[model samples]
Target chain A: MVKSYVEYTFKNSLPPNATVLLAAPTLPIQAEGGIPGNKGIWAGILSEMTEFALLFGVYFIARAHFPQAFKEGPLRLSLFAGTFNTVLMISGSYFVANAVLAIRQNRPRASVRWLILVLIAACGYLLTKYFEFRWNVGQGITGKTGIFFTVYYYLTFTHMVHVLWGIMGLLWVIARTRMGAYTPAEHEGMEAFASYWHATDLIWLVIFPLLYLLR
Target chain B: MKAMTHKRTIGLLWLLLVALTLGGAFLGETAAPGLAVTVIVSLTMAFKGRMVIDHFMELKTANRTIRSLMRAYFYVVPLVTVLVYLFGDRLARLTTL
Candidate 1:
């Protein structure tokens, strides 16, 4: 017979104060040793990683060939927009992670609130990115401007598309949490959404430095 | 008690992330591009990536295979970033057809 509660374990590598609960499954229970969220989501995450890896390859190669352009490219861009978007991305990931934690503790209402906060942060990212793009155009920085701008535009635009999907996923998860579709025992969908959102955040963390900070 | 602790941990991680982001910005704006800047930025990138992977993604206690894959990506990419910065001319020559 399947147990009522899933039996999972978080590594004790974290500080003792930050040790995670012994059992918290975002999805329905699988075998004793399963990945977070679920196998399906892991597959998706891996594919996303592969896609970004190729893009990073492109970025590195471009930077290699146009070192001077890469160095000066960031100077012409707005650092304010990059920093704002980074903060929003980090905050959104934080809120979503907290939402998962809240649901794990059987606090669906708190989870919903956290999810809402994540949505707001995600929306802020979109707004900031939109304005940043407009500012780029105003500065005559388009893909055709040079190899550096071309690589920057494609990498960032691809990331923005992922954020768009994450927003739609956030809406679905928020609605489900409000409807009481999740519990401490079963909330795989929300967990999957969190994982996806975090992956997007991870990609941006890398992109921000390569494009804006590494100069 | 455990839940509260985890919440606080997440909050702390977020604070650290914000601080690092600001630090990176300061370095980028003020520091000239060179080995020192490249090293610091590369290390910062790796650290930030690991924090998100292990904490926010809750992969620390995850399956060995999945966790390792994610961790490896963070490690490899940042290292490569540094390498590219240090050896761009050689890399460019090698890749040029």
Candidate 2:
């Protein structure tokens, strides 16, 4: 009776050809194209880049109009802090990339370690930015100080806000990772987070030169 | 083995990025405000952005459409920036509407 029930279920669940297809290796939806993580994340990244591009347009326009202010602005700012933050950002991005690689190799423990390093580097960035902001405020360099300062503050602060969000996402990914939520085949969450962080880092690469090294 | 190779490649890329950042800083400190420094700095920006997009974001393996879009973004941004730097006055006047 039990064998009859099992056979009945199997025959009803899958057709004969369907059984063979089910046993075959799965294929991707599209033969030649795919986005890392997913399409949604890529769309978000494109939107983020678009927004920054508009901001950059405003910056270049202002700089073209007031070259002297842009020239003299970086002199007063702390080049050390800017450089330090740039290093921290790129280092963090490197670690995050390593984390992604580690997970893809099914080394969740190694991935977690890399992620921890990323968080450490991110903390370093926050600390450096905090001191830089304090120094700026101490020297009366606020958004209203000048056009250059306004652009500087606007760009860097918006970036910091994004980094803050990335940090939160990192913590969540770490927790999920620790719980074995992701495997070698299914780790889109972690990859998406890494993509976001890398995009932020790329923005800073442009900002570092435009704000601190363009004299 | 493949994983090790990837890690090594990422390490090398990171070192190169660091070198470029410091070199750009040095150039900014010493070079006069002119086309040379502007071009060098702009090129560095483009290179760094490309590395991040290709290696870090893994866009190298993405579909043609997504890859082209991202590549265009990195290229156009730096190009426009350099152009605006060199021809700011004319650009401003042209867009004065």
**Top candidate, metric TM-score:** 1
Across A1-215, the per-residue lDDT of candidate 2 in tens digits comes to 99999988987888669778765634211124557777787788888888888889889989888889998999889888998899999999999998888787788999999999999999999999999999999998999999999999999998999899989999999999999998878898998888889988988988999999886
Model 2 vs. true fold: TM: 0.88
lDDT of 2 by residue, B43-87 (tens): 889899888887777777668887788788778878987898889
Q: What is the lDDT of every predicted structure here?
A: 0.88, 0.86
Query: Candidate 1, which CAPRI tier?
Result: medium
| C-alpha DockQ for predicted model 2 | 0.38
DockQ metric for all predictions: 0.59, 0.38
Task: Give the clashing pairs for model 1.
Answer: A11-B61, A26-A188, A27-A188
lDDT of 1: 0.88
CAPRI class of candidate 2: acceptable
Query: How many pairs of residues collide in each model?
Result: 3, 0
